[model samples]
Target: MDRIVVQAAAFDAGAEIASLREHDASVGAVAAFVGQVRDLNGAQGVDVLELEHYPGMTEASLAAIVADAHARWSLRGVTVIHRVGPLKPCDPIVLVAVASAHRGEAFQACEFVMDFLKTEAPFWKKETADGVSRWVEARERDDIAKQRWQGAGADEATQDKATHDKATHDKATEGTRARPRRA
Candidate 1:
């Protein structure tokens, strides 16, 4: 069973898990992830967030992601729920759950589904903070996370390692720089 829901109403993650467990007797493990709205985003104080998505397309995209996860793992069931519309801090945003006959498959499939959802899903988010509103930009880290599953070429991995090396070196030397001290 693959259950995908995109709505504005809040869903109970606990109930969703229980439902999946009851769906199959052969299920031995279930893994899940819940994303929630936060009060702060980096240096900004977020007042509220509005999520928008193309109705039919959004559901179809989610289904595709679930299908990919199923193909990669031996999952018995998958459940995904994503909320849209006005949401305040601490509100639930999304949920991804997977059930399998083994713990490893369930865990990997759950993570894979979320990684793809964050980068591939067609959901736009507008954040209002400090009398300002802006669309959230896609994070590079999310892209990198998704790339791990893409079988990225060794050249790309080498470049990523070099970038990480430079960042680490810079950080280690940052504190050694001379700076004006407060009187």
Candidate 2:
């Protein structure tokens, strides 16, 4: 089973991981990544981080990323949680957890989900520093990270399938490039 949540409330990472493995004795390894709001972005000192997204579209994009992960790996379960609204430094922003029969599959799937989420999800972020707020621009490093996953999973057939699926997802969510302001 896959669990996906997009909410404004903070989440418990340990609880989420436990939930992913519940009643699943076959899961021998679990990999999880928790992203937190940073206190600084380069030279600026960040006071708060605000995130916004088109509700339904954001969930759909995350689901597509998880689906792609399943297509490439034999994952027993997956959980993804993303928080929106204003958050202070150290607040958990996102969580990606993967459970599998082997460590390799779990680790790879967790990393793949995060890489895709960073680029594919239609989430916009703004940071406040020294009482000034500015919209955060997408980083080139994230694009490079996503590109590394291309043709790099499972067998050739699976890689082709994932590629096709990703293309379809990208086409479906392309219009969301123009992000909306925080409501």
Candidate 3:
């Protein structure tokens, strides 16, 4: 089973992992990653983080990423949850969990999902610190991480689709940045 969610609500990591393992008896190892809103980005103290995305497009992109993982590894189960809206420091941002018969596949799939999510997803983030807000730029490190997976698990066709999807998304959301709602 594969579950993908994009919401403004927070998620329970333990419950997600438990649910992933509960339905499958063959799952011998479960690997998970929880990303939280940090209090600081380098020296700047972060007060709030806001994430936004195109509703239908974001979910479709995530499904493609999960499907690619399934194509690459023998995963028993996978769950991905990414939160949006205004978030405070220390708030949970995303969760990626994978269940497999062995540890290696589970670990690799979990990492692959996260790496793809960071670079390929349509999410936009803005960080506010000292009452000033700035949209977070795409990180070179994340692009590098995503590049390493090329030609690893997915074949040329799958890779081409991923590239096409990313290009389409970038074109669609070219100049848009999520703005904070005034209170």
Candidate 4:
């Protein structure tokens, strides 16, 4: 809760790491994650990327992600930075570093925050190929990734919605199968 950073420019991982370590002696480990812009998207190879984020909502959204991670685990310091605007291949897209008394908690918190950010964060990435750019939507892989990191016990409504959605989807598939196919 003491540290919050959300920016539209590329972040320096080494400098950030050093800053995190300063004035924090109780931390036994600092785990970090940095996401980059890859050059491939399906059939085409991406040459550039234009990322956009809601100004007001973006900060609030990332802060909420940090807060959620702190609430879920015992964390000492948390820092998250995501870049916007145009980016090239190998450019750092996001950074997440978590400090805790132990390594396990720090690692888990870092990964968890990333997974949640990929799925829940408001930033959007649009891959550009030969100057064509399109907004990337949430993917099934992202959802699955987030699902894997969900705490051992989740809230009642979330559990209920997951179960309810599955049941509804299953019934819909069954109904389609039971009906005659169109010629």
lDDT tens digits, residue span 1-183, model 3: 889999999999999999999967988789999999988766565488999898999999999999989887778899999999999988999999999876656877899999999998999999899889999999899988887778545664575575456546645765432221111
Tens-place lDDT per residue, model 1, 1-183, is 889999999999999999998958889789999999988756566588999998998899999989888776678899999999999888999999998876656776798789989998899999899878889899999998888767557855774575456546645764322111111
Per-residue CA lDDT of candidate 2, range 101-139, in tens? Answer: 766568778999999999999999999998899999999
* Residue pair clashes in candidate 2: none
When 1 and 4 are scored with TM-score, the better candidate is 1
In terms of lDDT, the poorest run of 10 residues in model 1 is 174-183
What lDDT is obtained when candidate 4 is compared to the true structure?
0.74
Across residues 1-183, which tens digit of lDDT does each residue of candidate 4 receive? 346566667788988877877788977779999889887755465578888778888888878888878776677789888888889888998889998766656776798788988887778788788667777777899888888655355653564465456546756654421111111
**Candidate 4: segments with Cα more than 4 A from true spot:** 41-46, 151-183
Model 2 residue runs over 4 Å out of place are 41-46, 152-183
Task: Give every collision pair in model 4.
Answer: none
- Where does model 3 exceed 4 Å of error? 41-46, 152-183
